[model samples]
Target: MDIYDEIEIEDFTFDPELKIFQHPCPCGDRFAITLDDLVDGEDIAVCPSCSLMVKVIFEPEDLEEFLED
Candidate 1:
């Protein structure tokens, strides 16, 4: 359970289809978090294959555009 790093939201690539934010993990997998997760006030992105997690830096208000249906 290692806390990897704190990364800016801008550093993540948002997938409109998946509606998630993605960043490449050093372990070859990806750190991902969904827009719902963000809207729910979550700030951590985790790698599905590993224990690495990163803190996401973003304002809840900043996620308005992504939350739109």
Candidate 2:
């Protein structure tokens, strides 16, 4: 299954400065993504540390909300 297909964006936050979404990987791994790297409506990300490509479904906004709490 495609990453976008599995992902359901309940919330999201756009960070222009960072150029990436601060969110968790759909695989349950925490990671970050840049706007240039992301294709809208899709759940794909390149791991910074491992450089392993990942499919993400969680919205960045959800991560922000979690952080605020």
Candidate 3:
């Protein structure tokens, strides 16, 4: 399905402990994606409780920090 919205990667809150980026979804669930997912070149954050998806605007170069050494 097409993304419901576009959220700048900077808009995401990075949880150092959880190692994931999260943003509140309109559906009352959180739209989330892990660092691993970022490193793997994934830019879609999906709300676990709904079919809604958001496109994460990110640069490949900015993903270096999330990549495994």
Candidate 4:
């Protein structure tokens, strides 16, 4: 399937402790992707409880700030 939405990295909640980014999904679950994944050029976050997924719109530099957190 295609992405459910295109969300900015700024709109997502970054968990410094977990080093993951999260956003609410319409399926009552959260979309999640790890910092490592982003660093590796990954941009898709998927919701574990459903088939929906979101495309995380960001550049490599966008992850620089989160690197310290």
Best by TM-score: 4
| Cα shift from native, residue 31, model 1 (Å) | 0.2
Model 1 has an lDDT value of 0.91
* Model 2's TM-score against the true structure: 0.36
For candidate 4, the 10 contiguous residues with the lowest summed lDDT are 60-69
Residue pairs with colliding backbones in model 1 are: none
Question: What is candidate 3's local distance difference test score?
Answer: 0.88
Q: Which of 1 and 2 is ahead in lDDT?
A: 1
lDDT of 4: 0.94
Local accuracy by lDDT, each model? 0.91, 0.50, 0.88, 0.94
Best by lDDT, which number? 4
Q: Per-residue error at 11 for model 1, in Å?
A: 0.6
lDDT of 1 by residue, 1-69 (tens): 467899999999999998999999999999999998998888899999989999999997889877785
Ordered list by TM-score, greatest first: 4, 1, 3, 2
> Candidate 2: minimum summed lDDT over ten consecutive residues — where?
1-10
Which has the higher lDDT value, candidate number 3 or candidate number 4?
4
TM per candidate comes to 0.89, 0.36, 0.85, 0.94
- Residue 2, candidate 2: how far off, in angstroms? 12
Per-residue alpha-carbon lDDT of candidate 4 for residues 1-69, written as tens digits (9 for 90 to 100): 699999999999999999999999998889999999999998999999999999999999999998976
Give model 1's TM-score versus the native structure: 0.89
Off by over 4 Å in 1: none
Cand. 3 TM to true fold: 0.85
Q: Between which residue pairs do clashes occur in model 4?
A: none
